[model samples]
Target: MSTLDQSRYLATPIPGPRSQELIDRKAAAVSRGIGNTMPVYAARAFGGIVEDVDGNRLIDLGSGIAVTTIGNSSPRVVDAVRRQAAEFTHTCFMITPYEGYVAVAEHLNRLTPGTGEKRSALFNSGSEAVENAIKIARSYTGKSAVVSFDHAYHGRTNLTMALTAKSMPYKHGFGPFAPEIYRAPLSYPFRDGEFGKEIATDGALAAKRALTVIDKQVGADNLAAVLIEPIQGEGGFIVPADGFLPALQGWCRDNNVVFIADEVQTGFARTGAMFACEHEGIEPDLIVTAKGIADGLPLSAVTGRAEIMDAPHVSGLGGTYGGNPIACAAALATIETIEADGLVERAREIETLMKDRLGRLQAEDDRIGDVRGRGAMIAMEFVKPGTLEPDAELTRALCAGCHAAGVIVLSCGTFGNVVRFLPPLTISDDLLVEGLDVLELVLKDL
Candidate 1:
């Protein structure tokens, strides 16, 4: 058992003297483009607690943007990394090759949502994984056009910048991006004007409308793949209505378009399932995974059908540091910990607790327009009371309040009006409830 205490303890104010000093130093030393949600500097983090340089322990609800689903500094991951480092840190898988890399690929091939023959190639980040998946799809199909949805956030790279939907921070003035990428409408049940309250019953129709746009605008014969997040992360944690994913997957199959599920923030037991696509029984041709894959170590993967994955030639898919031995070891141990500790079930339990508490909050506050998501990946969208108008100002205020009270929260959405919660699976019930209590108090004040 771990000895780390999971609780919030504010010694001084948030960003106390030590952290404030570091923040000042950071302004002078670091780039201005890098943004931070909280001003505190972490001394250490374990399980659900982040101990700042000033000794203030804050409840971590963001999990470093869903990168530590198993937990920050999880023992298994630390142990594996240490053992691998003691043996050898980096041989560069391309040059020397390592068993850990093969083992991780084998595990991903078996674990990702398919029973058929599958293969995986590791990468350094989600953007790299997504880029490689697109390359493989285009190579296999001999097509140039690719499709992504509105409100999607793939990454910051040139190709992924073209794929991402939001523009302000990720893509503004960063164009001209890669060509042949088309945008489609996602099945957003809350804001779909056509169906309104009946969106749940109109999921199939919503999907057909989006597909119709693609069919007419891009044409089926010219498209290489259709990429999407199983449950969008930075795009407000939007979970499509039932039948939406299935309809899209069926259309992709009919049109011979590779259906790619970007599970960067929704994979590895974070969504009460191994992968979010599994929840809807939609098997994607290529699945891009990262964030939670290696317990915070930089690791990503593109796992998919053997036929498509094998389309690339020798030296066609790999990077110098793509599958670092330490990261591979960490991933293997992290996957072991998730399975042995039953974190998938823990995620479902978190969903129940969060929904019960946040649902009551929604009932009491009309400004909370919608409370949606799955497993530990839940979010609340703020709107003008009784109206669909997004309230970004209210969202900012609520997040600031939480930060001041020694709780870590994060905001997302194209409009920046959604508060997302992605707590580690190892968090205790009491600590989770305490975090929720802070949020409830903040909401009441607003």
Candidate 2:
């Protein structure tokens, strides 16, 4: 829907005149808690590029933190939203009910990774879905304790703050977090290498290490859920070791624990698979999805086993704007576009291209500690030239250089040493390679 060209073009400097003016106003008006990665304010966006207020067509590698998977202003989503708004925006799905909400729940139940009888409840965001899932697990199993892994980024809510691993920025001084939330070790191959070779190679061993701690600290009998991101997002694009996810799922199955996959960042074909759990053949009892569900619209869901989801009583799970009609319409259209466009396969192709490119770069540079992730959701972890020590300096420099060159790259990780790349699946081959070209130049300069 953008009028500007699809490729990268900078008519002015990164922030430009108008963006600088907006930035000045934002500082005066907006809260400091919210931050933006791209320096310029967006005027329009389509496919893989964002046109800033100063008439700069910049490559959007971040994809609005993996939210705009189907692409910004997708025609299908736009038309659906327009049509739904023309009729009515909301009648409260909880009070009056609507076909759109039911249809979305049906789609999630069918498409999610499982053949069991399933049900879904829609929410306004990933955080809400997560909190509700935990509540459902507790109600069904009558357990109060929960286990979360290291390097997990759930959300900013009070309960999720305790669930998250990072301290500063996400959970700094968020005093006296929720009770009975426990932290466990993750199967981080790159970091585990420094611990021991056997642990690095065998994911089951790492799971055992965590499970033992869980047994001693939080006892599986009292545990309500084992919530985790299949691929850790804000902590870094960390893909666990080979058997990591499956091992944890197996233990959760043996116990009465609800294994919840927080697929907020990795769902909706953002990863090569339709869902990241499919890659490892791990079926979660409950799956929390958002970010990419309705193109750019705000919608989220907690889909799970029917018995588990049905545990809550009537009037238990909902909000004023949960499953808004407009967002539901947008979600249905987004799924249609994804299926019709063969985006899942496109993600695999992107993985082949990006991993191959970054793999070669890693071979050449010692500072590039690891290049990991699935589909278009790839990341590079920076470290000291000859050691495992995190090099956050290099990561920040790389991000700044990319922004200066009109390519929007994002930084992440607990140690602040990861540079993630999440280009829209609809991006042209030439444009994708051109973005990589910008990244290479940034690396070379750094």
Candidate 3:
């Protein structure tokens, strides 16, 4: 197997004969509940392109749902994983510890927001990290009620499903969720009434309104933690108005409620900063991270204040495969790559290019209700022209068009009318522009 070409090439149809064969096999072997955005099967991926089994190169704008920030098959991550695998794959940190796992924890402790004494616990996925964070919060605060915002997506587990707000695929039939999880209003600037007109001016007020709701509904004295995405990921890439985070954090501090920043998708320099909370100068009490943490490895972590993290009893936080040596090695290398290669700065460059291209598209298309996000995590919400009514049908058509034309884009939003762009930070300017060109053409056709 050779590295994929870092440019678009369609040797066959979108889901060519080979991919169709694989898709057929998958349908027979895999569960119908597993959703696939694109029918093509990937052979290999590098930089910003995914080469399908049929030899079609598609520009990857989704970046495996923001997991491949450094890029697919990153040399540093690949080398680290190979070397660690040869040495040792797993020791199950709980039973027998490894240097790599400790090193990764140390790195996360120092890197995540807040200069205070911090500690970390690793997990295999974002949902696990979030669940652990909640557990720690409850243990420390001695409270059971937790608050999550509307349109927020923590994970798919039973507890996180209760934290999540979207209904259809995530929480349609999975009813009778965990108890004591409450929902609060989020400061969605694009959709919020009146505040959308002057976000900067009304942000504080919006924050106060949300806080008021939480105070009234979920009493401040009864809350363990207020979990939120610094910049919401699955909820259409919604960026809260300025002053909103600060106000919420302040309220949490005053009321002794832990503020947990779910940086799973927005961490690891995806938002031009190492963590999204850094952009607002807010230091969360606890931070949940995953996605880009180990480039492409299965890793997640909850890093927080020392006292709170230490509140859990001995053997309370360890998992069999939580901090596997291989994944830890990849995380160490991924962090080093981010710092040495200056991928944080690269994310800002990608943002500039995206804003320039998508801004022009938004100007041309009235259906583009809003264009928002930071760094490489950008999105455009679709709606009826000159109206706020969501146009999910158009959003789906545009994504399908991009897929057929050898570009991979993802859709989100509570109303299912958001098209998000999360290209790898390592994507070349030419490749990024080319992908955006395909998106522009698709929008125009729609």
Clashes of each: 0, 1, 0
Q: Show the lowest summed lDDT stretch of 10 residues, model 3.
A: 193-202
Q: What TM-score goes with each of the models?
A: 0.98, 0.99, 0.98
The regions of model 1 sitting more than 4 angstroms off are 198-200
Give candidate 2's total backbone clashes: 1
Candidate 1 residue 241 Cα shift, in angstroms, is 0.8
Report the C-alpha lDDT of model 3 over 138-180, residue by residue, as the tens digit.
9999999999999999999999999999988999998899999
CA-lDDT, candidates in order: 0.94, 0.93, 0.92
lDDT of 1 at 127: 98
Q: Which pairs of residues clash in candidate 2, taking residues 3 or more apart in a chain or in different chains?
A: 235-413
Name the lDDT of candidate 1: 0.94
Q: What local lDDT does model 3 show for residue 37?
A: 99
Q: Every model's Cα RMSD, please?
A: 1.1, 0.8, 1.2
> Mind sharing the TM-score for model 1?
0.98
